[model samples]
Each structure stands twice: as structure tokens, then as C-alpha cells.
Target: MGSRRQFIKTVSASGAGLVAASAMGVMQEASAHPTSVWGGDIYSGPHEMVKNSKILSIKNPDGTETLGVVTPKGVIDVRAVAKKMKISAPLTLDQLLQEGNAAGFNKVVASADKSGVPYLDESKITYGRLFKNPGKIICVGLNYRQHADEVGMARPAVPPLFNKYNNSLAAHNCVLEIPPPEISYKLDYETELLIVVGKRMRNVPEAEALNYVAGYCTSNDFSSRDLQLELPSGQWMIGKTLDQYAPIGPYFVTSDLVGDPNNLKIQTWVNGEMRQNSNTSDFIHNTQHMLSYISKYWALEPGDIVFTGTPQGVILGMPKDKQVWLKKGDKVVSYVEKLGELKFTLG
Candidate 1:
């Protein structure tokens, strides 16, 4: 990548950031969700595992590891269904690897297939803690060229990384209180793909980075640009951490089924109009290299999230004459493949 200061200087209005760098020779192309046009014929249509689903804590005779996924019409008591026909719920991939758990998971899914639950109207479901991640939340900025230009930031020699506290998490249906009137005037939204770590790992190699990832989801890395740019030292968290800035997820689909994470289409919608649209293929530094680099300093675990980065078309991307910062009554949706759409309204 290019230096943040030196980056925008190189691109006129057309943004040279995407074409300026090439890390994944062919660019691994996978949609954040199966429904994306990026990879046609990739999804197995609409499966029950996703679409109108909710996970919950349940219990049975075998002790625990009992979990249920609520579908559109009702709950699919996975364990209940499995035991009726001799099956089990898989707690980890190890269960799949061990053979026993895989048998049980298959049986449970088979039973669910027979349930009479109707298709869920996604718009009606109540969002939960998408992924109860007990791990660190990591983010990369200016990973997209257009994002760099809007802020007049040069690209970095590597990924422009940062962090946000878990305290900032918001679900798909909550309301974000506009930062206190005393703060910023330029509140913005960043739609990006979120990588959930599936297993514990440290000193991981780029070659094996994908294995450490559990799955993918969507996140709106909301920013108060004025507060973000307030300090001359450019400390991101100041602007990044003002309450309710991160809105993420509708579901957490297993990564094994997600295929490639780098190639998904990322979309952000304000109110009902599309604003930010781009593919992960444009990430100046892709996921594989990012996980490898960060693993050098931090030990990632089963729940850590790596927000790859936002694509072009944010509020900041517009010319000064056309920019309109977000405000109350605004509804924003950030979506990735399989992860579904994360929708929130501002009050």
C-alpha cells in the first residue's frame, strides 16, 4: 500500500488506490453472502441454517452442548429433534472431526428439515449479540483506495489498523443516540466485512490464516469524522469510540461454508438509497495477509473479529459540495454475504 499522506496525493478524482496495489495476484473472489452476484451459482439456494435463524441455549439429557436455532415460524429444538432420531448438536468442528458429533449434527439437521416452521421474514426478527465474541475487535482503515481519498489520507505501507471497544456494539434494530450535541458534526457510516475467529491461534502464518477464521458477518464501523479528525495526532479511537458506533451482524455463518472471504460484495444503505457499494476484492490488503501480520503481536482466539475494511462510497467519499452527514431518523444497513443485513435506526 502507499503512505496515508502520500496516497491521496497520487490519485486525482478517480482514485488510484485500487489499481496502485495488487497483493492477491488474481484477487480471491467470494461474496460475503451466497446471494451476491459476484459468484453466480455458488450458494446451495436458501438453506435452513441461515435466513430467519436465531441461536439459543438449550439443555437435554446428555448434559449440555444443547443449542437451538429459531427459524421464521418457530424454534427447531436441534437436540430434541436429534435425540428423537439418534443425533447430536456439534459444539465444535472437532465434533465433526471426531465423527460422532458430525453424525449427530447431520441427524439434527435432517430432523430440522422435516419441521413445519415457515420461512422467516428477516425484517421481523429481533437481533441479538450476533456473535458473543470474548475476543479483541480489530479493524483496518483506508484499506480501500476510495476511502483514503475522501479523507485525504495517503495509503499505508501496510494495513492501516485500529481497534474499537466491545462497549460500542449495537445490534440490527437498536437506535444510536446522535453523539451528544457538544461533539461532532460529521457522523458517518462504514460498511465492512467482519471475520470471526473460529479457533485459538498465535504466530499464525498467512498461508494458514483462513483456518483460524470461524466465519464472516457484517458491521457498520460508524464514525464521527469531525471527532475522528479532531486531534492533530490523529488518534482514531477518540472518534471511533463515542458510544454506539459499531453496529454488526444478523447471523454468524460458519466460515468453512463461506469459501473465500476476500471476494465478497460489501454494501451500505442509508435510509432506502444505496450509498456504499464495492467488493472485498478491492481491499488493498486482503484478509490472509492481515491475519498473518496481526498474529505476530496478538494471539487471536475463537471469538476475535477482524473487520477487513470498508469499500468506497462513504459520506466522506462525496465531494465537499455533496456531503450530508447522518442524523436522527436515519436507517443504515450494512450487509455481507451469508451474514445477512444488519439494520439500525438512529434517533
Candidate 2:
């Protein structure tokens, strides 16, 4: 695992050098008004700036550390007391997103915020994951035009999708594992903007697919290029799902608040070095197109994640002479302008 120092160094470099920076399918028609949407009134921005109005840690608001999400009535507390006893102190990301009466969840945050909290200096919180979940995680590879060019591949007309098991999920304070030292080392960091599906939709049109998104988060599609490219056949999935291949989190922002999925900035850093820098603006196939395209093939379900491809500056794109694969203890950080940072250790 990477020490905290390395993680901080990498994240700071990438996050500082630039402003950093999805969804799917359907055959359904969204109403002009999405009144039932959670946090329908919430506006989009960095979590630190507006989470204070969110409800989190309600039951023991002043007690444990947790996220605070903005709600119409005020903030709907996510970590508040649950009806059942023997619950854990902090709630998982998936819990908050599951559809239901947030009433019980809110009560805990309301009660806790009524008192001591320290997750963030300010009481307000933004979501991370809707709640922790057990589900299949899907990702897109080389989905961006510039990224494909950088890697020396022709642009794929359709989204290049891949899979990563739950083990790839990483939240803040995570340490990514570097490839085993003996082989084709070259583990790299990729900055990607990710979205989670809130509802199930199959065969959705491109224009209507965005309606199924629940929220957005940041992810680092960490890869071992050497191992990935080891096979000349060019089947991309093998190199995509490394141990911590996907570092996701910081928080999940609902689609209602994020106006345009294609315009955010995405950036990456490796061990305090600025490596990849760009924006969602460069995507070859934007979210609308991907959603519509993917829907023609598979059904997108709630909690399913879509990680838009990373931008340029990956190691594979670097001149081999100057290339250096991530070693054990290296820190890789992927940041999206609005979603926040996803950090991990390569140990």
C-alpha cells in the first residue's frame, strides 16, 4: 500500500496543475419535470463549497465522520441513526443512493448535526457513493478521441467498454497497488469522469439516455500498460481491471445538478508529477452518444457505473525513452474538476 505522503504528493501535483474534469440508455421518455429526483433543488459545484446545506451524520451528526448532501427541506442526513440497532457508525456510499424514505436516514443526520462533527470542519457534506453496493462495475476504454490518438489507435466509432470487479472501487485515502515488480511494470494513472445509473433502461435513444443517471464521481482507470499490451491481439479488457484498476469516489453528484456531462475538466498526477491534463470537452464520443450506443446492446441498471475514458499523457503515449512505470509505494491521483479526487497507493 502507498503511504499517505506519496498519495498526497501525487494528488496535489495533478489536482493543482489544472482544473480537472456519462450515461446511458433508454427507450423511455423523461418528463419535462423530474420532481421526484433526490436533491432536485441542489446546485452543482465542488462539495466543500455547498455541502453544508446537505444532511449527513444526522443521528450522531456531531459524532462520526460522514458526507452531507443538500436537500430541498435543507439537508438530508445520510449517517443518521437507522431503525435497526447494531449498525455501523458511518454509512457506506451505496446506502445513501438506494431509493426509499430518507426519513430515517435524515433523522440521524439532523440529530447528529444538532451537536459535534469532524469529517469536514464545516458540518455540510456531499455524497460519495449513494451507498456501498455489491454489483458489477463497467468501464469504457479509449472512449476519448484525443486519448486514442495519443495511444496510437484509430478512433473507435462505438464506446470501447470493459469490466472491473468491485475490488477496483477506491474512495479517498485509498492506496493503489503497483504491479508486481518482476515483470512489465508500467502501471499508469488515468483521469476519468464517471456516472452511476439510477434507473434501469434498455435500448434507450441517445437523446434520452442521460435521464437514467443518478450522479457523477471521479475515477482513476489505473492500468499496467505493459501487461495490458503484452498480448498483441489488442483485446483491451485484460489490462483494464488490475487490482485497484479503478479508483472511484470523493462523492456522487446527481445528474439533475450536473448540467452538462461533457464539459468538465479531467486531470491526473503520478508521484507529484503532472502527467495527464485535459477536459471532458475532448471526448470523441460524448456521453449522449455513448448512452445511446450502449443501450442498443445492454440494459443499464441502477448502481451500474460508467467511467468515461481518460485523456492524453498516459505512459503508453509517452516517448519510451522517458517512460517510467509506477513502482511500489507510488501515488496516483485522478481528479475531475467538479467531482473531486480519487487517490490510491501502488504498494
Candidate 3:
């Protein structure tokens, strides 16, 4: 498979329309959707992708992942249930959203629930990366008021934007291997709200931004402070996008269920101690503003994700004398209201 950079280069070299048509053809062949259109268009207005659902990505023994839906009974393996019932369904969450197969997926979920199908216990199943290959992983820096105050940096007139590569993507409960100490050891945990875009957005208005969101998930923006801030000019991307540095998931709760994304409570814990306790209400630039602002510059597409920004209480916020950076064997847990807890260990 081609790298995201290479894919972008190809999309740039060739017009977006042509590339999109080709991709749509591939998706049509694999899923139930015949056209690329999933949600409403800009003229028709935005709409949420999934509703009242908690989605999961289950890792298979053969190194593949399948889509699962959380039901009162248990977690329904979409692929297994679809196969047994001879129903057409998207095999993975990525395919479901990216290929405009939400209708098919919803059908599978509804049918599975009423068909007396056997479902697997979520606790016993191995989790996979909720998002495997998002087109973009945009991040907002210093959007939280307390975090900016703690870092002693003036709040920007506009939201600061940075990015991470797909390689940094990790699953909940996965182990992250820290880089060698010679590389730098000032590792920190950043608990933040994550937004998953469900529809295409370009110059979207603040009032309608939430309509384009598919759902929200618990995510940690793990950072290597030395590489991010101590470098010559500061290497924000390099420090933020390391192997398995961005661990998200446990569950992807739909937008309707989450209600107001900007009013949610978010927190982080190191071992058993709470290190950060704040709410998205402290955002200098809330979810609406961030999405509307970003849409002004770049078109946000389906399956793309954005990290809203972490709050105060990071190690960098503490005075130099009291600073004790995170080390190997440390366990970090991130939580956002309505979104499940995301836990990982340093190896």
C-alpha cells in the first residue's frame, strides 16, 4: 500500500475528482454503496453518520480487524453476523464510513440485535485500532485556556494546527515502546477530546460543524517534550508522531449520544493518581470554532480525525524542581465523558 504522503501526492498530481471517482468505484465493488455520496452535500447541509451506537474494531487471530456493534446482549461481530444471515455489510468501521456504507452497517446491527444471534463478550475480545487509516490526523495546539496558562504561552488569535501520521495510531490496552533515553525521555500524557468527521466539510459554518462529525472517542496525545520543544526550532510533528504514540478507543460513541461535544469532562491518570482534571468547557476555541476555522483552509473528509487539544496538568506545566517525567512500565488512562476509558502501558 502507498504511504499517505504518496497518496496525497497522487491526489495533487491528479485532480481530486478523478481520484475520488476511482476510489468510489473500488468501494462500490466491495460494499453496498454504489455512489460516493454518504451524508448530505454542502448545499443540502450536514448530517451525523451514525446514531445511538457504540462501534468497536475487533482484532482477529489472523491479523485482520472486523467491525463490531455494542448491543445490550453483547458486541455483535458485524462480519460474522452478516455472513450467517447472508446480508451485505461493511466488514470494517473504516469501510463503513469511508465507503458510504452506513445504511448497510446499520441494517446489520439492527438485524443482529433482533435475530437472536450470538455475540461475543467485549471484555474477552482483543481490540484493534478504531481508525486504521484516516486521510488526515489534524491536531489543535493550546486550545485549552488552562493549558495555555500553565505553559506560560499567550493564547493564539487563531487555533494552532499540527498533524500526526497514521504510524502513530495505536489501539486501547496496547503497549507503547518508548524511544531510547538518548533520543529524549521527557514523555508526557495528554488527554483530549477526539472528533471523527463523517461528512465532507469546506468552509462549514460553526453552527453546522457538529453535523459533520461521525462520533467522538477517548484519545491521548502522547508527547516527547524534549524533541517537541527543546529542538532548534521545535519539531512538533516529530515529537507527537512516534510509533504507537497516539492510542485511541475502547469505543467510538456516536455524535447524537455524546450531545454537546464542547461541554464534556476530560481527564488523565498516571497509574492510579489523577494528573489532569478538566472539562472541554475550558476550550479557548471550542469544537465548533476549531472545525469551522480548519474547514476554511482545508477540506475535512470522511474518516478524518481531529484532536481537540489537551487541558492543563501536564508535566511541562509543573515547575522545574518538581518535574518528574514519565518512565517505562507506567500506565496511562485517558477518559472523556460519554467516551470510554482508554488505557495503555509504556514498555
Clashing pairs in 3: none
* lDDT score for residue 276 of model 2: 84
lDDT of each: 0.67, 0.63, 0.88
Give stretches of model 3 more than 4 Å off: 1-48, 113-116
Per-residue CA lDDT of model 1 for 1-347, tens digit only, reads 46865766766534554554433333433333332221122323212222222343333345443345546556555545655554434532222222223344555655776654333344444444453334588988889877777668787779877899877876667788877657777888988888777566688988998877756778888998887776688769878866778877665566766778877888888989999888888877889888888888878765678877788888877888899999889999888876678888988
Error of model 3, residue 271, in angstroms = 0.8
lDDT of 1 at 81: 66
Please give the range of 10 consecutive residues that has the lowest summed lDDT in model 2: 43-52
Which is superior by lDDT, 1 or 2?
A: 1
Q: How well does candidate 1 score on lDDT at residue 50?
A: 25
Q: Give the TM-score of candidate 3.
A: 0.86
Most TM-score-accurate candidate: 3
* Backbone collisions counted per model: 13, 48, 0
Comparing 2 with 3 on lDDT, the higher-scoring candidate is: 3
